[model samples]
Structures are given as C-alpha cells and as structure tokens.
Target: MAISPQELSLHKLPPQNIDAEQAIIGGILIENDAIDKIVGILDQNGEDFYRDAHRKIYKAMLSLSNQNEPIDLVTLSSTLRSGGVLESVGGSSYLAALVESTPTAANIIYYANLVREKSLLRRLINSSTEVVTRCYAGGEKIENLLDDAEKIIFEVAQDKTKRSVYHIKDLIKHTFEAIEELSTREGHLTGVTTGFNRLDDLTSGLQPSDLIVIAGRPSMGKTALALNIAQNSAEAGFPVAIFSLEMSKEQLAQRLLASRAKVDLHRIRSGKLKNEDWPKLTTALGILYESPIFIDDTAAQSILEIKAKARRLTKQHNIKLIIVDYLQLVKGRHDADNREQEISDISRSLKAMAKEFNVPVIALAQLSRMPERRE
Candidate 1:
C-alpha cells in the first residue's frame, strides 16, 4: 500500500512532548492549584501543547482560571462544552484518563518545562528551515536576508519567539517598587536629569520612554538646544546618544567646545582662538572627552538604521538619553507618497525606539512654512 500524505506527515512529526502535555493536563484536572503552578513554570498559552485535544483542554482550564472558577474536571468540561469544543477535546473520557494515568501533580513544573523546551526547539527548527529556504531562493538583498535570519535566531535565543502577557499583580508590584524608589531620591529627579534645574523641576527630569519634540524655525538654535541638553545629560552621568543628520561630528565638537568655553561660534569655526582662549578650549575638550556622549553623523539615515544603531549603543554604552538633531531630515523606512505620512512614520518609529530602549528621546523638528516662501 502506498503511504498517503497525511501518513507521511505523521511520520515526520515536529519536536513534541505528548507525555509532558498529558502530565500538565492531568495535574490541572486533578487539583485546582496545579493550574497556577503550571502557569507559573510554563508562562505559556494553550498553543504550547503538542496535541490538539490538550490544547483545547488547556484553553478551557485557562478560561476557568481567568473567570475565577474552579479547575476540576467538571468545570473544565463545562467550559469546553460552552465553547463547543468538549467533544473535539476527546470528551470527558480523555480528561478522566489523563487524570488516572498521571501519578501526581507535584511534578507538574518539570513536565511543563519539558513541554516548553520542546516547543522552543520546534520553533527554532521551523525558523531555521524558513531561513534556509530563503537563502536558497537567492532573490532578496543579502543585507535583508542576513537581517531576517539574525532576527529569527535572536527571537528564539532570547525567548521572544512569542508574545508574553504579564500578570497584573506582577505589574502592580513593579509600579509600587518604582514609586517607593522615586520617593527616596535626593533632588526628586526620578528620571535621568537634563542638568537644567528649572526644566528638570517642570518635567521631573527626562522621564524614561518619553518622546520630547522641540520644533522651531530655521536658525532658531534647535540644534544648539539639543546639544546643550545632550551635554547636560552626559555631564549628569547619564550616557547620551546624538544622531546628527544635519551636522558633521567635527562641527558638533567645535560648537560644543565654543559653547562650553563661552567663545564666539564664528571664531571657533574660523580657528581664530587667542593664546588665552587655548586654556578654556582645552578644559572644555577634556571635560567633553571624559563625558559619555556619543555622536553619529549619518546623513539621511532611515528609522530602521537609527533603531539598529540605538540598540547597539544601548547594549554597549548603556545610553540613557537620545538626541536626534533635526528629525525632519531623517528618512522613513519606506518611500511613501505623502510627505506628511513619511514624517509621521518617522516620528512614530522614534517614539517606539525610545520605549524599546527605555530612554528619553529628544527629536528636534522644523516648523513648516510653505515651500514657496523659502529664500
């Protein structure tokens, strides 16, 4: 007899742990508290189970737990029935057999770990296979292909292959702890300080994950203001990252030195430093060199590139504040037809990047006048 496709698929099953799944289900049906134990250990959802029946049964168990109802065989079966899946989950007979076959609920955690391990392995294999297939196709850009492959492997290795839902109690506990810690700070600057006492007082310093937009007309000192804030934050011991799309790093350094030494910007640019001005410039340079301020003058950078660089800076230098000089110059990930839409996407990506790194991002923007009004 020739083997059918279904039979062939059955022969080549993905990594799984049916015995572990059964133990997990049996523990949940046997004891109401076992669900809590399994949830805590697995931190997973119904889809983590290998068997279809186990998945449905686990979903019912989660529903009961969420509803603050019991998780015994009867309540679970009732929930499954209400959801019109009791028969599909092998009825109550399979559930009963699961409970009888498993010796005890004490080892539910070990069994849950086994199931999670198998699930992770399966995800890795699938991701790797997809990456291999794409590599063989040879049509996409090499850079894009590498990025996709790295992202896939990183997701699996970082345990970010799936979205995680945190319990409310845990979130509340973290909030309370943060509140307590903030209360004990000396200057009452709960977040990273911007070094401006008045501004710090008004905003409680630069709060983490905040997107601060500074908009102004041309020659309005927007870059100057951003650079000042970056310097302040760095001096205050918070590492700062500056993405200068409008200025070169040398120009930025010159401006910083002139600003710190209270010298003329024009004189600094012209290299007309007096003999006495050398000491002041040297002092400013020494302080700035020691401070944790990083500058990247990548012109016309896309949002994705900015995010990638920011992530690297965060991991390498633990940057707490980011300053994008003149955000209007930054490019979007895609070339959209509408200019406003492109700018909107860029702004959204910057905000999202701030949250992802838990840093304060101060993006300077230009106030738009009509294009025809330009000199």
Candidate 2:
C-alpha cells in the first residue's frame, strides 16, 4: 500500500518519560577520547570491513534499541557474527577494536549494536543513541522518523552521485565514439516501426521506453493505423503483443487478411468471403500465424492483468513491443471519483511498465469531445 505523508505523521510514537533508572542506564557514559581511538582504528583499517561486517549489526541494534532492549558487548558480538558481519568486514577483532574506541556510551552501545546489526556506519557515527532512543521511546515526532529515514536517503543519494559521476566521465570520453557509431549506422533498430515511411525515418524506428499514444474519435482509422503498424513491425522480425479490448482476435485477424488480400473489411466481417477469397484468406492466415504477432482479445482487462500478460509474453517469446487497443477501457487498482483520474493512472502505469521492461509501448487512446487535432 502507498503511504501518505499525513498517515505517516500520525503513526509516530510519543516520547518516553526518562526516569532515574532510564537515566542511569543511558548515563553510563563512554569518553569522547575513547571514540577517537575507535575512529583511529577504523581510519587505520579502512572502511571496507565496517561497511561489510557492521552494516547489519547496526541495523539490528537500531531495531532492538527501538524496542528498548539493553545492549551488551557479548550479545552485540554474537549478533554481529551471526548476521555474517565477520565474513563481510574481515573479522571479529576489527569489530571489537572499532567499538572499543567509540566515544559515547550511547554511541558505543549504538555502534556495538550497529556492528552486530550491520547498520550504516556513517549514520552510526553521526547519530547519537540517546537521540534515537528518545525518539523511539516517544514515537510522537516526525523529526525523529525523518532522522532515521535519512540513512536510506543518504545511501541512495550517494549511489546516484556515483552513477552520475561515472556517466559524465564516460560521456565525455565517448562523445566522438558515439558520433562515429551514429555516422556509420552499423546496428539494426530493435523496436516496433510505425508504418509511415516519413515517421519511421524521423524516429529511426520506435525505441524502447517509448509511449506512443494514438488518439482519434469514431471512424478515423485509428484501429486500422494501429493494426497496420503492428503488422509492419511484426513482419520486420520484431515480436509484438497486441491487446484487443474492443475487437475479437478473429475479427482483428480477418482485418489483417483483408488488408493483405485487398479485400473489404466490411465484406469479410459480413461472411461474404468469395470462392477465390478462401484461398487468399487461407494463405494470409498461414503467414499471419507464423509471424510473431500475438493477440489477446479479453474485454475490460485490469492494468495488473495486462502487465502480467505482457511480462509472460516477454519471457516466453522475447516480445519487443506491446500495443493496447485503448487506454480508457483498461481498469486501474484505484477507486477514483472521476474517470479521468483512472485514465491518468492507467497511462502512468503503461509508461512505467514500458520503462520497467525496456520495451516500446504503443497504447491507443480515445480523444475527448473535440474536433481532430494533429501534432
């Protein structure tokens, strides 16, 4: 379930009342100089061991501390070793040295817990155990929750920064190489091709992560255009998956046959197939079946079902493109008061799925009550 910010605000625990016992427990203070020693050990040994061994230990310590568990060194080491910290960080001795040098009792306890839990080392170093414990005990402050959440946010930011740095460096070095590749035109375009010769030229074929929305009112050949594009792409050796919410698979196939055989779609639908037409239809069917154009004719499919089917097609046949007949007909998981919101969600999900699978998604949509507009 998606969590709203308001609901999250309501879920925080109230602050605990720190009595004499609590104070005494929290007051068993370790010196700042001792913390410097711990820092020295970590600095000398490097960060790799702590990053590996103490990562989980830190996390579990946070969890246990949040639940008000009194932490001890023996228990911390056992938890650390059990959580695979020894193998990750180098050894148990490294964990002990780091913990011994930590500054505050709270930090020492927290670091010990963290090394056992394998929590984030930087967060452990920066955050005070007293502050974390106070928040966990009180549970009323969003600020406290935000502080805890910062660890994850910081890691993500760091990862993104690293990726961006690498990408920028690579881009600088390979700009000429990329230009050369484009100049040479050495690779085949591996996506669905829109049937229009001029459009195909402009796009160099529809690339993956593309959301091509074809919109039209009644009798504007929207379906025909989509079918033509699907057929053309499939014929060009790319696997295609088509979801037919408005028309049956057989009906769509007959339209393909009529298009191929130069017969009338109306006549084919009306069962007026001629004696000569039988041979042409048979030949068309044989060719269409052999091609990598799969069709699903289920009515009023939910977005989840569409996603599942698309994934299956991708896995089974390596489908490179997906075509949904119309977006408004598809249902979403949310119960919105307006149909527009539902449509928006469906469109968003389609775009997300396209990105998720790295495939081009062409979804047909219905225009509002307005005259035709061209892009």
Candidate 3:
C-alpha cells in the first residue's frame, strides 16, 4: 500500500532512540574500525536513523567506506563539505560533539542493535497508523482493505533484515543439493512441470520466480495453451491459480473440459455432444473436479487486487503456479501517470509477485502488428 498523507503529517514523532543513533555515529568516528562493525546493521536506506542529521552523517560515512577511505572526523567532515551540507548538519563541531558523547567504541555493536530495533519499531507504528487512517477514510472494499492491511504487515516482515550479499562457497552446496534432489526424481525436472515434454526439457520446467509470457495475435490459442498448462499442473497435485480477464469462469471451464475430454470444443459450446462423448466428458469432469484448479474471472482487475488475491491463494492453498490469461486487460493502479507508465508498473508488479510467492507466473500478451508491417 502507498503511504497516506496522514502518515506524513507531524502529528507526533515516531519511535526513536537518539542516544543509540548518536552512540553509533560517535563510535564510528572514534574508532574507524567501528564502521565495519555497524555497516551490516545500519546499511539500509539510512532508515535506521530517525534523525535527519544522523542519516546524512551515516550516508557520508558509507561513501568514505565505499571509496576505501577511513571514516574518521577528517574524512567524514570533508566528504560532507564536498557534498555542500556540512554547515546544515552542524559542521565539524557536531562531529566532535558526537565523539565526545561516546564513552567507548567497544559497545558499538550494542548501540547499533539498539538503533535497528528502534527503526523497525518506527516502521511498524507508521504502517499501523496508515491502516487506521484508511479505516476511517472508509471508501475501500472491506476485503480489499483487509488484504491491504495484511500485505502491509507481511511487507514489514520482508523488510526486517538488512541487505543480503552471500558468498559463493555457501551457495554452491545449496545448488549441489538441489541437483542431487533432481537426479533422484524420475522426470528429472528442477521446477514445476508445464506438461510440455520439449519445453520442459529445454527450460527444465517453469522455475520458481520465472515470469513466462505467452504472446501471439488474437485467436491464436494463447489462452488455450495457458489453460492446458494450468490443468496439467493441477492434475499433478500442484495447486494452480488462473486469472482470466478475457473469459468467464464457465467459459474457461468448458474449454478445459473440451480439451481434457478430447471432445469437440465447438460441439461442447453448442451443446451438441454425441452419446459416446458422455463417458469422456464424465471422466474429464471427475478429474477436473478433483484437481485443485482455482479461477478468478474478474475483468479489468487492478494489479494490486491481483497481488492481494494471489497472496491469499499462496497462503491458503500453497499454490505452486499463477496464470494471468492476458496482460493487456489488467488495469494498473489509479495513481499511474499515464497508460505507458501504468503498463510498466503492471509488468514489474507481476514479476515481483512471482518472486514473492516463489512460484511461476505466466502472463499472456498480444504482439502489436507493427513488426509484421515492418517486415
């Protein structure tokens, strides 16, 4: 959810430990070695500092550290001066004062931890305040509002830790173990199977965090292809979710039945099934009924709505895959600058959702005929 105006108003100050922030910077100034120790703790967008001046000071320190320079008073003050903000941040006098306030640099670790804890607390309070303000505003759908609240809380959890930079030595064993697991499986696929033999072999199935786009001209069976993959995956005991902006759930169900039961799609749509088709239709019905294939045929759904619903399915059903029938039909958020910008947001949100749920997202798209005209 976007931050509300209510959150920005100076109604009250958020949670902060000024002493801790001061201690961290003071320790780093006193002992250049302390910068190395606290980088992992205060390395986030400087949100860890509640005071604006402290944030600026820490950013300059980070810059010096990045340049392989020491983080002492001489270097930090000079860097701030070069950036033209030394006077605004209280200058050399302030830097010396921070160092004076520090008893010793040995307790830098404890001070850093204190600052981080206060930062997390501040974020929580601000988020909860936003939710409460929205509740009073009282225009959103109850379900959507609830979903928004849940998403905010979950995002706070995702943002809890600092940046991650892993060494390859640690990653190699994890990769090798994954390979071992794949080798023991009969099909030898490392990701969710799309039920296409050649495609699965080439791409090793649809890996988690993959954003697969199926593009074509209209009436090119793009929706059919996606539905088949969803059907096959659900049949294999992997929960699947389908978001259809171009068709109704009943229509999709009929298509799935016609494809799975090997009956004529036109005949099924026209209610012209022959007597022999009954058994095949009945068997397909049982299979599909038993399989865990969920569909939301909401047209013109906003990207946020899609994400909220998808997150819910991921939590409740542990859905292994998500399929958006067509991308151009989904609406972007209302706050977009223009159509082009909205489309960009929609694409990125889809990619982020795939990573968030650790599942494959297949979005269907239509290619403009400009290429054909050019050719």
Top candidate (lDDT):
3
List the candidate 2 regions with Cα displacement exceeding 4 Å. 1-190, 274-279, 370-375
Against the true structure, what is each candidate's TM-score?
0.50, 0.48, 0.51
Model 1 whole-model lDDT (C-alpha atoms) = 0.75
Query: Considering TM-score, where higher is better, how would the candidates rank from best to worst?
Result: 3, 1, 2
Write candidate 2's Cα lDDT for 1-375 as tens digits: 986434553575322221221221222222322222122112112221233233354443433332234445555556656766645654556445544544335444333333322223334433544345556578567875777668656753452232100111122232222111101211445445666677887887888998889888767888898888877777666778888888876677667778866778887889987788876665555555555777877676776557766776788888888899988888664446788887887898899889877999989987765543532
Candidate 3 C-alpha error for residue 205, in Å: 1.1
Give me the displacement of residue 271 in model 3, in angstroms: 1.4
Instruction: List all candidate RMSDs to the true structure.
Output: 13.5, 21.8, 13.8
224 Cα displacement, candidate 2 (Å): 0.9
TM-score of candidate 3 to 2 decimals: 0.51
Compute the lDDT of residue 47 as modeled in candidate 3. Answer: 71
Residue-level lDDT for 153 in candidate 2: 64
Please give the lDDT score at residue 247 for candidate 3: 87
